[model samples]
Target: MSARPTTEAERLRRCRQVFELAVRDRVSMAVARDRLARERWAEADARLSAKNNTALCGTAAPAFAETDEDGDARLQWWQR
Candidate 1:
């Protein structure tokens, strides 16, 4: 049988996965921010509001938060 992954290898794999996901998320956020800057409020809001249910995959993280210029709390997709 093939050798199993070592603990260090598994940790590295998880870290890599997190980094890749963070990169993808940053790219997407940048695009949304650009569109928002262009006055595409609805689209930007929708994108930012989109919820990521990583819990389904068994990973739990803190929820995202956003506030409008008026200091009003924004609703996330999960909140909708």
Candidate 2:
């Protein structure tokens, strides 16, 4: 039979797997946060007067977009 992987190589592989899993988990958490923030913004907008609603929605949208981009980057890194 073929020889098994050396201990060092096995350890390195396990480490890589762990790192990838961490990245995935982090991305998931960021996405969830973004979702919750958007929900809150929507709720507040519904309750607020017209003038304040515009300002709150504008401030929250960029943060949501940035988190989405960050999550995408992390997913691409994990694939590598």
Q: Considering every candidate listed, which one attains the maximal lDDT? A: 2
* Residue-level lDDT tens digits of model 2 in 16-66: 655565576665545655655577689867778564455655664333333
For each candidate in turn, the TM-score is 0.26, 0.28
**What lDDT score goes with residue 42 in model 1?**
75
The TM-score, computed over Cα atoms with residue i paired to residue i, of candidate 1 is 0.26
lDDT of 2: 0.62
Off by over 4 Å in 2: 1-27, 49-80
Query: Residue 45's C-alpha lDDT in candidate 1?
Result: 66
Candidates' C-alpha lDDT: 0.59, 0.62
What clash pairs does model 1 have? none
Q: Which candidate number would show the highest TM-score if scored against the true structure?
A: 2
**For model 1, the run of ten residues with the poorest summed lDDT:** 69-78
